[model samples]
Target chain A: MDLIESYKEDLRLIRRFGTGFWIVLLLIGLILLPWFAREYWVYVVTLIFIYSIGIQGQNILIGYTGQISFGQAGFLAIGAFTYGHLSLLGSPILVNLFFSGLMAGIFGILVGFPSLRLKGPYLAIVTLGFGIAVYQVFVNSEILSGGRMGLTIQKLQPLFGLSQMTTYYYFNFILVFLFTLLSYNLISSFVGRAFIAIRDNDIAAEAMGVSLTRYKLLSFAISSFYTGVQGGLYALLMGYLEPNMFTFLETITIFVAVIIGGLASVEGSILGAAFVVMVPQVFSNTKAFIPVIYGVTILIILIFEPLGLSGRWMKIRLYLRMWPFR
Target chain B: MPLLEIKDISISFGGIMALSGISLQVQEEKIIAVIGPNGSGKTTLFNCLTGIYHPNEGEIHLNGENILRLSPDAIAELGIARTFQNLRLFMNMNVLDNLLVGRHLHFRKNPLLPMLRIRKEEILHRKIIEEIIDFLDLQAYRKARVADCPYGVQKRVELGRALALEPKLLLLDEPISGLTSEEKEEAAYRINEIRGRFQMTILLVEHDLRIASRLADSMVAFYYGQKIAQGTPEEVQRNPEVIRAYLGDD
Candidate 1:
């Protein structure tokens, strides 16, 4: 049996030293992966890291805050374009990334205004409209987004005598790590509780002193910020920006990641991102059947593992902990 | 000055008046039971006071401040906490988290501090929550999700949530409506202990007259959106209109 000696122990993210050791070992493996793996696999893993950041953002809005958003691609485009434009203007890489997230977060607040009075499908439609509008604007605005021709970004200056690819990989790895840590901290606090409370029962949440307007907008802003950062990373990785890149299909892919990863979980986001990224690679030879495979996998997960892969992992861990007994 | 003063408060839905010109005064540290038949606007008054519904006319003063203009959360911050007729506990959260949510207002609002795992403030709040858990005798279910809890235990968790706010005025709508006799007795005893231990002013809406009159310092009776009687429990029980409201006129 688990015994929590204090509230601090109860609040710990990694409760046991064994878990911490394993996590550290896993992180070390991830850090050294680029040296041993082929460049193609390294590239795929980098894309997974970027998508993981965005998926965590979606999880916060849909999973933790109970807000349905289908316009995450809009925020992604905003981040990508912001990063591209800022980098072209000779801004520092860090500053460009920060502005990318900040710009998307500002628009997130704008989308959140409609959510004050709307819920469920109505809110989803509004966000979907937002995603389409963003795509159209980028496609039409020649000066802003290069108008269908797309923008190209220069590679980063290699750091610590590492190869350019490894540098980019490390940049993404550090960011995903920091963002995951931040999400974990945010989820365990009073703000996180307030978000859950609003999700479960909004009226009671208001009565309990949680301002609906403030927290709802805050959820949107934070979620979009994460997606925006991912967009910046994506732009850096691809070295190209096109309006068609941030399509409605991309938003749905991110949503599927949240569902398959498990809602309100950090590890779920990472696992979900890896699953989505790897599945397409697995079916690369028969690209036409990718969608069908995804559908079947999702159906199976929903039917048998409703809590998703993370939940299933947890159950397996519990069973092993109670081995030799049914 | 009275702790809470309701002056000619009236609310209407379409054409139906839920409450009309209902006025009353509640002094500090007193239990005032509002005993009324169903559809008599007892819950309506609680909603208006908590700022869930905007009254078309009249004023509500808490600690001598006009509260009609404040939003529900603003009123909550002004030290008014309530429990719903139907339990509104965060169903997915554990009991400990539910009580911690009650202390939402008390926790600092800096998003960055908690994100860094700042334990000083959280530990302080947890101490208060532990005391509430002890008071409510919810140790066994402390980590259990609110949805998994038994009905009677859920009721105590609801009460514990309200108490966690440490409000000056506590509004309880039907605190013991659905419970076994033994649970009811335990709840009544706890309700009495709440007033004394917390030194809080309670505005309770209970249908059981025996428990209501036993625990209340005074009683108010409502009928058809108007106050029919207001006085000592025995005095309100003796009022002819209150008698007619409960039983058919003969």
Candidate 2:
């Protein structure tokens, strides 16, 4: 009985302290990373953070609610443009970020109307078309895209006591952390439960009093908000805005991150974003094989761990904890 | 006034009439069992009443308010809850989570609270879920995913979910057709208990005569999308049309 009680306590401890401990340790690692790593590596890590934020939004849509959007880059473009214009106008960085997300979220609500009546491949087509259309509109607009010559802010304000790169990196990190916490909260709440119910069996969800149109649009708006914020961060990091940045392939990369990370798992988005962002660096010398390597890695992940890296990580952790006994 | 009144409700699929001019009136706090053979329009009637299908003609009234044009969730919000014939529990979610979805209508819209880990409303609602779990004897299996649970457990979870709505009326679609004898008895007991405890009306669809006769306050029989007979259990069970539909003329 005493042994059983001790085992139970151990399980409780693991449940309570496990996530917080890892998060703190990871934060420490990230803070120390730039000090030891080169400038290029710091830039790559910043990109990873931005991508992770976008992928978290994708996870909410595709993973939690089982909705698909192939035009995520459309929202991202809207965010990036909003941020670029606001920053050029000498607005505070925080205000720029907030409005960037606000603009993208409004667009998300517009797109969400079609999603109410569409599903599967039909929805995917609409989103795909939407992404390309936004890209074309931005590319052709002289004021927005600077007539294909692109736009740039003369200077970006950095937080005091930090270098430009360091400030941006930390800013991205802070936003990622805040948004991850937000996603976790939403997932465990009534709104999140309703999304899963709609995903699993919509008729039952409706029968139980979940409004189909309301939640569908809500998920779209919320996910777009996250993507829009990430877009602002991306524009700030790049210091330049180009219509090409919001291409169809960009949206595909975000989708890949969500799938490879684990649909519906918050940590999966981070892992997937990191992998998509950094893996290209490893094959920088082998430009011809980049797509090949990317394809092969995704195929393997899908076959062996359909739930993505998060699922594999859980299995590994469980195995390590019960090692030799199992 | 009757708690629910279905008047001249008709529905068709590709010109094939599923329910043709069928009507029903359910009194407040009384159990009404709908018994019919397969393809006899029992589920179609429920679907029309719940807004899963729009009747080609006629009206549905809940407490004197016309609800035919309302969406399913809107109907549910106006104090209606239902279970499915095929056990439509969210297969990806655990039993507790499935039941939590049942409380969707009760939650105040606060999307940001859970992110901050606030639990004021969640804690309150969870207490209600706990009560439901105990009432359904789902304590042992609350953590189990519905996809992995046994059929009998899934059926109970579905019922528990509808109960969580705290609706004025409960629509149970074949609640005990697939259960073991013991499970059936348990379900029968719960049905009787629910009527007394909640003082809520029930529209039960059952193929089992024994369970229907034992539990229902009144019984209605249907044949080919039209009402054949309705009265006490004995009256319907002895009706020639219901007998011919079920047992066939020999």
Candidate 3:
């Protein structure tokens, strides 16, 4: 009983002050990382932030709304291509990225209109088909993608006189921060409550005055906006665009990331994004082992820790607070 | 105008008629108890009113405005809320969140602005939910997840969630059917208090005749998807058809 009371005190302290301190510490580390870390590691971290944005959107839709979407990569491709097309026409990068997200949101609404009516496997199939169809069509269309050879973006001047990589990294960091704050605000508010309500019981939610069509579409559009922004950033970072870049496998990887990170949690998305992005790199020498490793890791997480890596992280914190006590 | 008028509503699924040309007129601030055996179409009537199932041929007017064409949420926005026979209180969420979800209609429609801050609207809505919790005496279980709560508490939470919507008309399907005798009495008291305190019309469907008899201002009895009797509770209970339906023609 005494241990339990002490543990509660520890938890209160963590909740009150420890969390903010850790977040500030993490931010400080990230800020200083680019200056001290290898250039390759900085690039990898940038990619992780971009993917975190996309995964966070997925978490909102899949975790919060209980909607299954396998076509986030399609929106990503749309954003990248939109950026590529507009940038080719001499628009500024910022304007192109903004339009890229806009175009993706429009496409998301288009898909959401028909697909929101589907449930379970049908929804997944429709979204997966959409992802594949977008890739195939873009690859075939000479107007969109130079007929599979792809379009190359010229090296542009870096923002604020920083190196291209540093500028890109900082820009991504700001976006990730803004989106994290936005998602945090959203998940704690009534809108997020509505999403969880719809997810838990649509019939009850509808009877209580939640508009299923409107909220579902809103989730879809906002999620697509996040993925689209990531896509736009990807184009800027890679300085090249191709239909092949946003693959079916990439879509699956993102879905896996959301699940592995823990559904419906912003922290889960970040952890899951980092894990998925880094694992393949770790196994780069043995390409065939990557799929086996991914599958095994997911299975283990599901069987042993249904809440995924973040859930385990939580348990670890609790265990540490209650050390040596049952 | 009657507060709610269901005129000649008929809904059929293939060959089986769920509700057949049933018309009901609900006056403002009245508690009407609908009693029937299982599969007798009491729930179907509530479904039609809430726009879950559209009547094949009928008109539904709430305060003289036709509500038959509206979607469920749109109908809800016009101030009609319901509780299910089987409790459907967002089981994964805590009681507070479930009640907050009931305020979905009161939220701003932009969906973007709320993502920036907690917002004054949420604070205002939270106050409303707090009042509902106080009314329902759910302060003890405010943070308890609905799934973790007992059946009685779950029913209370469901009622509290519906009340949070602040609907002009509340449709309750078997609000106390699964409760213990003590829980039933408490639920009855709350239901009675609700009408006077909230100034809302109520249409309740219950299988418990004794509780219905004591609680309902009026009573409607259903037998085989048809209304056999509707009047003051004593009048409905005295009708031969209602007796035959419940007792099966001894």
Candidate 4:
């Protein structure tokens, strides 16, 4: 049995020595992956990292905060286009990423305003409208999205004798790692408690002195900021920006990742992102059957494990922990 | 000055009056029990005081400052904490987390500090929470999910959450309504102890007149959205209007 002698120990992210050991081992594996894997596999894994960041954001809003959002793609689009324009203006890549996230976060707060009064399907519809509207705006505006021809992003300069792809891969890996830690810290703290409290029971939460307006807007800003950064990374990855690339479908895919991976879990976001990214590649030859496979897989997973893959992972851990008895 | 003062407050839903011209004063460190039948506006009075239901007319003063117009969170920040008639604990969160949420107003708002897991600030908060857990005898159930807890334990958790706020005035709505006889006695003992221990005023809504009268230094009886009687528990119970309200005119 794991015994916590102090409150600090209880609040630790990796409480157990065994868990920390496994995490360190996993980190080593991730560091070695790019070297051993083929170029296609490396590219796929990089896509997973980018989507994982975005999925973490979605999980924060929908999973932890209990706020429904269908406009995640809109924020992603805003981030991508912001990066595209800033990079064209000869700015540093990191600065462009920061500005891209900042711009999207500003829009996120704007979208979060309606959530103060709207909930469930009403909030969903408003966000859906936002996603569609963002796509339309980019398609129609030439200066913004290159008038349907789309914008081209400049390639990154490789550093320290590494290939451009490897550099991009390392950059994303570092970001994803940092963001995951950031989110874990966020959820475990007072801020995360407020968000969960609002989700579980807003009335009691309010009585406990948690401001609904402040935290809801804060959740939006933080969630979208992550998605926005992911969008900037996506722009760098593809070296192109099209209005069509960030359609409602992109939002749905992210949403699916959150649900299928698990709600309110950082590890779930990574698992879900990997699943969504890899599945498409796995069925590249049979692209038409991808949707059918996705639908069937989601239904099957939800039916047996409603909490998603992370929940199953937890059960497996629990079973192993109680193996001799159970 | 009284810790809380409600003056001629009235609220209505469409045409039906939920609370009408109700007024009361709560002194510091005293237990004032409100005894009433169901739908007698006891809960509504609590709601108005907590800023959940805005009174259509009249002013509420907390420490001489007008608070009726403030939101629920604002009222909470002004040293008023409450328990719901129906339990409103965060079911998905663990018992400790539910209490930690009660310490929401006390924690620093700097997002950066928590991101870094600043040991000093976090340890301070955790220390306060640990004390509350000990006081409420919730150590065994600290890590247990609130949903999995029994009803009596859940009720204690609700009370513990309010205590974590460390408010000046506590409004408890049917705190022991659904508990067993043993749990009821235990809750009553805790309620009586809380006034002296926490040094806070309490405004309690209860259907159990016997327990309410025993716990209260003073009692006010409500009947059909109006105060029927107000005095010491003995005097209020002896009043003809209170008797009529409870026992009926026939």
Clash-forming residue pairs, model 2: none
**Positional deviation of residue A326's Cα in model 4 after best superposition, in angstroms:** 1.4
Q: For candidate 3, lDDT tens digit of each residue in A92-187?
A: 977987898888888888778765589878998898888989988888888988675788886456888777788778888988999898888788
- Model 2: per-residue lDDT, tens digit, A164-275? 8887788888888888878887887898898999899888899889999999998999889889998888888888999998888788788888889998899899999998
Clashing pairs for model 1 are none
**Residue B115 alpha-carbon offset, candidate 3, angstroms:** 2.5
Ranking by DockQ: 1, 4, 2, 3
What would the TM-scores of all predictions be?
A: 0.98, 0.96, 0.95, 0.98
Off by over 4 Å in 1: none
Q: Write the per-residue lDDT of candidate 1 for residues A1-326, one digit (tens) a residue.
A: 57889988888889988789989999999999999999888889999999999999989999999999999889999999999999989899889999999999999999999999999999999999999999889988998798667899987788999888888899999999999999989989998999999999999999999999999999999999999999999998999899889988788788889989988788898999999899889889998886787778889999999888899989987898789885
Top-TM-score candidate index: 4
Alpha-carbon runs more than 4 Å astray in model 3: A1-15, A155-163, A322-326
Q: Which numbered prediction scores highest in lDDT against the true structure?
A: 1
The full ranking of all candidates by TM-score, starting with the best, is 4, 1, 2, 3
Q: What lDDT does each candidate get? A: 0.93, 0.89, 0.87, 0.91
Q: Can you tell me the DockQ of model 2?
A: 0.62
Please give, for residues A1-326, the per-residue lDDT of candidate 4 as tens digits. 77778767877889999899989999999898889988788889999999999999989999999999999899999999999999999899999999999999999999999999999899999989988999899988999997656888997888899888888889999999999999998998899999999999999999999999999999999999999999999999999999999988789889889989999999999999999899889999998886777678789888999889999999998899899877
Q: Which ten residues in a row have the lowest lDDT in candidate 3 chain A?
A: A4-13
Error of 1 at A314 (Å): 1.4
Which ranges in model 2 have alpha carbons more than 4 Å from their true place?
A: A1-14
Between which residue pairs do clashes occur in model 4?
none
DockQ score of the complex predicted as candidate 1: 0.88
